[model samples]
Target: MSSKQGGKAKPLNQPKADKKEYDEIDKANIQKKKDEEKMLKELKAKAQQKGAFGGSGLKKSGKK
Candidate 1:
């Protein structure tokens, strides 16, 4: 079966996929989510290391 790329919007009126295709789609979505999370983590780590925007911690306000 042909594989569809991630992040593409599916039409609401489209027919449902069969078991195998559905499984594949689910797997693809899971992978995409995981990859996105990993990338965000890496980016955050890099930012922390570089002190980008003053690392990952919240800043203290001098409120009276």
Candidate 2:
């Protein structure tokens, strides 16, 4: 294989990408993930508050 194909790139042949653009995109993705996690956590806490449907399900094994 040619050295260029399996080794250091030929700078003249490659197009350079803007670093600032990548940084902005990465920041936006991080913020979006944080928001989703917060929402899921809130939902779980709400569900645990009262799992039973107003005391109207299977009876307890040994309770009055």
Candidate 3:
């Protein structure tokens, strides 16, 4: 009988070298995303505090 006819075979385990490379890439991508999010959050806080183009530095504007 053919091997396929017997049953589905288990997939081969990943080699240590390939696994390490993938782990490093995954970690780098995660760190980069975290850094970008932190920067965006900081920019948003600054923008809210300063108003558009840092105009007037007041939280709200009022006509005198």
Question: How well does each candidate superpose onto the true structure, as a TM-score?
Answer: 0.46, 0.47, 0.47
Quote the RMSD, in angstroms, for model 2.
9.2
- Answer with 2 or 3, whichever has the higher lDDT: 2
Global fold similarity of model 3 (TM-score): 0.47
Better of 1 and 2 by lDDT: 1
C-alpha lDDT of all candidate models, in order: 0.83, 0.81, 0.80
Please give the lDDT score at residue 61 for candidate 1.
84
Positional deviation of residue 63's Cα in model 1 after best superposition, in angstroms: 22
Candidate 2 C-alpha lDDT tens digits along 1-64: 5544666766676677766644888999989999999999999998789787676888667865
Give the per-residue lDDT digits (tens) of candidate 3, residues 1-64. 5545556878899867653455888999989999999999999998889766746545755876
Q: Judged by lDDT against the true structure, how good is candidate 1?
A: 0.83
- Which segments of model 2 are wrong by more than 4 Å? 1-22, 53-55, 59-64
Tens digits of per-residue lDDT for model 1, 1-64 = 6687779788779688766555888999989999999999999998778775745768788997
